[model samples]
Target: MMMKKGFLLKQILWISALIFMFGCGSEEQFEQTASGLEYKFHIKNDSARPVQLYDIVEVRMNYGTHDSVLFASGNQTIPFQIDPIYEGDLLEGIMLMHLGDSATFVIDTEDFFVKMMQSPQIPDYADGEDKLYFDLKVVNIITETPAVKARRLEATERKLAEEKTIADYVEENNITVAPTESGLYFIPITEGNGSKVKNGDAVKVHYTGSLLDGTVYYSSFDRGMPITFVAGSGEMLAGWEEAILMMKPGGKARWIVPSSLAYGSYEREGVKAYSPLIFDVELIEIVD
Candidate 1:
């Protein structure tokens, strides 16, 4: 009986040892440290296109340090500004680091803005939130660095400067409008009894606009109706807002818009930089 009891105890010890080993091996270990940041990646395509260097990516990241237990949480879909450090060409950073390798790089927001401005790429503010960091790793890659982050900043700055010059040229050349403090000029054609335009009025008016060189930029005659906009709101440019105020339902007039009141210094597809603009506008109807 003594030998039998000793054998049963040995069998129980062996079973427990096996169970312990199995538990440890099953636990998943990450090659990248959470470090307090999480990148929630969504694949739009299972066999997705290769990630480019300058291509804007939509990533969901928890922008905080790993050491903090309580973190600020929010969702962001912003463009990733790829610089030259990645050598202007690479298939994907993750493929270079391997499928599971991860790393973090802390970037300064103010400095980022200054750098972007230096290139003159005036980025439009989607909502005006400032400063962000990017944490990335290669998931898959078929190529290595060689693609260049194109220089669009200088072109953007040139466009903005040109628009401003256009506005200034109109003003300096005796373009003739009764100016207001809000950077608008009004020239009235018809004297009507009704209010110029109401807050909720569905106003319509035909309009034709041209550059200083007699190049017609836009014309409502082609569109088949007058342009409509809400008054006292940002629906129209500064010049348009001021011009409409001087019109009645059937009034016709002209407006010389400065670059400040138009597209600023930014160049449009066909519109060159710093070109002054002219508009011969007509108010046809106001549907209240």
Candidate 2:
């Protein structure tokens, strides 16, 4: 009986070991082999241009066993965040990964991209359909964290501040405003046409927005028209709705927006946060 029990214990131990190995294998997307590197990648370049080496590239790259294919490659921009691109090989960004790292992806290229890049030069394979395969390796990588994160952050703040100064200059010379409790200021540009721009009314305006330093962030002028948004019902920002309420139809005015009225100081991926902004706005139409 003891011998039989011992044999059962051995079988159970082996099964547990196999499960552990399989779990570990399914962790990262790609793995390495004798032939080179191997993995599938997600394709996201929907534009009619080829993916550039100067851009950050990320894929589900793996270089190991069969079970390692667990997660689909999440977004990984190559050239690592610290090392800004400066006109060299775009592939240099991901070249810093280790031997076992892998990326899986699907490549999407546009017709013009194929013509411009003559992409046939790279090592890739087609899988019987529209899909192409990419198996890459880090022959090497630029393993330095170029900027201490804090300093880089400060530099970005300084740039935004500079942009704001320009917007401030525009505001200083043009309009008059008074601050209110809602963190938005009011200026009586024109008299009303009876309806107060309360919640639910659709409002349209032509606007050009910039930092105080004068870098334009958004503009309805791009479309050569005004944009429409619902008011107090909340399709617009708090500051915008408040400012519009002060103006009547046909009113043209400039608004100096505080950070609390804009996207606040939260740093967006590529844009600085907490930026004081200015907008030259014309209330062209208000729809019910």
Candidate 3:
């Protein structure tokens, strides 16, 4: 009986050692950081600078569990600005990485779901597991500055001409369409087909923009080139985005953009503050 007990103990220890050495092979390389995070460096660039606070970062990211993928930024080259949700979370892990570094950070499923995601409970699909692996490759990090955030030059005197000028133009042009709930007037000249425009869609458009006083500021027609901007990406003015969202491919519309929807209270290039804008816009293509 003593010899049998000794043999069992030896077998248990041997198996434990084998699992520790070879179970996942790379398990030894992972280092614990924070309370519930673990990370391993597959590629590290010692010369590159680490990410800083409020810096906009472009990352090729795919976060998932052992068996399933939850979300992926597929072929989207758009950058994500990092703001830490907690003291020791995924954003902090990202801050630890340098440019061109490839690493994998393991996050707790409970922390991800309950804490960060604000879900009621861990989902049934991740029932037995408590870790979500984020395979990240730090692409580019842009330092945050006021110039990049708000490009305001100087506060200009308010003219308050937007409302009256837009009203006058609409009356003169025989435009008769009720304004939308957000105080935007979109008059369609041609109908389009397919899905309604939403965020993350690359849309190509041809536009001619002018002040209500008939001063043309910018036009794609004169340049002989169409401009493309992502929908809901803040690449264009609010009035432009709102009107384009109501359009589809091969559609054309006239948008009367008040200063509130255009550049409000700040003088911009070739346009005065509080000025109403008129745009003849055509949606040339919608790249999915």
Please, what are the lDDT tens digits per residue for candidate 3 over residues 219-256?
98788888887776544566776788899899998888
**1-288: candidate 2 lDDT, tens digit per residue:** 101112211211110101112223342554443323333322222332333322223333221123332112223222322232222211332333342243332233221112212221121221123322223332222322445456456646755674455345547766455457644545455554656566557778888877666787677888686777666542344467567777767777777766555544333333365556677787777875
Regions of candidate 3 where Cα sits further than 4 Å from its true position: 1-158
Give each prediction's root-mean-square deviation over alpha carbons.
20.5, 19.9, 17.4
Worst 10 residues of 1 by lDDT: 11-20
Candidate 1 lDDT, 220-263, residue by residue in tens: 88778556665544345546655676677777776766655654
Ranking 2 against 3 by TM-score, winner:
3
- Stretches off by above 4 angstroms in model 1 are 1-178, 191-193, 273-275
Tell how far residue 41 is off in model 2, in angstroms.
30
Off-target runs (Cα >4 Å) in candidate 2 are 1-152, 155-176, 188-192, 267-271
- Winning candidate number (lDDT): 3
TM-score of each: 0.43, 0.42, 0.45
Error of 3 at 253 (Å): 0.7
Instruction: Report every candidate's CA lDDT.
Output: 0.43, 0.43, 0.66
